[model samples]
Target: MRSLTEQDIRSSFVNCSKGEAKRLAIPRDLDERPWADLDFLGWRDPGAPDRSYLVTERAGRLVGIALRFPSSQRGFLHRSMCSLCLTTHPGNGVSLMTARKAGAAGREGNSVGIYMCTDLACPLYIRGKKVPEAGGRFEETLTTEQQLARMTDNLSAFLDKLHA
Candidate 1:
């Protein structure tokens, strides 16, 4: 992924009002992000832990979406797999992050969700830069590139549901 500017992110939102996008929190440490290793930029709002954001390039344009999850629904009893990266996380490490659909459907309260890394660090986990507390990645015959492609496909499918 390429490094993105604040303006780029604010303008990329597809599911929220322009004013809401303008007011939403943008990460402060943009320069510190591992852009080359990232498939998308995602972060939870510091002030509102239940609210999160994600931005990525799709079909030659940047697409951004706001997401939310039940903060109180922590998974402390068992391990769960992140649908995007296939990494298993124990406890509150995975969440059902949901995004409002784009256009009138979203206005009608339609939304889509997927089980994802709680920290929104699927790329890092897949690349071995971050490790889940439950265990390391499961041994797989696929290479890193294949893994990344799989993750991207998973995300694209979720995005497709939002448009559907």
Candidate 2:
């Protein structure tokens, strides 16, 4: 959970061409992002509503993914837990965040979705964000390791679900 730049996010993409990444229509207000408060960043492509982006730090380097739309949810998204940075959100937040599966997978049009926190605030959810609830999850339990585990588990589950 460190601060990231628009460039950093742009460069982390593994599935898209450098030119495509650079040319991607990024949000103009990059400077106004709550960098210090974000655990990771997620956004949808302006031109392609079906395309999306997510950035996170794994091991020490930054990693990003270009995700495609899920099968198609009519008003409601599927209910699954994110294994990466566990912190469940309403189905509204969970979406099929399949990377435009690269290589042959991409050729085969394979994609995977991630059930993620709607707000994408695993860090805040774990460390506690400015929720108004009096005795919510954060107030009752402030365990860091547990939070990390949930995050990891949520992401793992997401990966597993993609193949299932």
Expressed as tens digits, the lDDT of each residue in 1-164 for candidate 1 is: 99999999999998999999999999999999999999999999998889999999999899999999988765466778899999988777888999999999999999999999989999999899998886457999999999999999999999889889
Q: Report the lDDT tens digits of candidate 2 across residue range 58-125.
A: 66777676676644543433344444554444444555555655456655767665555444455555
lDDT of each: 0.92, 0.59
The deviation in Å at residue 19 for candidate 2 is 3.2
TM-score of 1: 0.96
| Best TM-score among the predictions, by candidate number | 1
Position 126, candidate 2: lDDT: 65
lDDT of 1: 0.92
Q: Give the TM-score (vs. native) of candidate 2.
A: 0.66
Tell me the TM-score of each prediction against the true structure. Answer: 0.96, 0.66
Cα RMSDs, all models: 1.0, 4.7
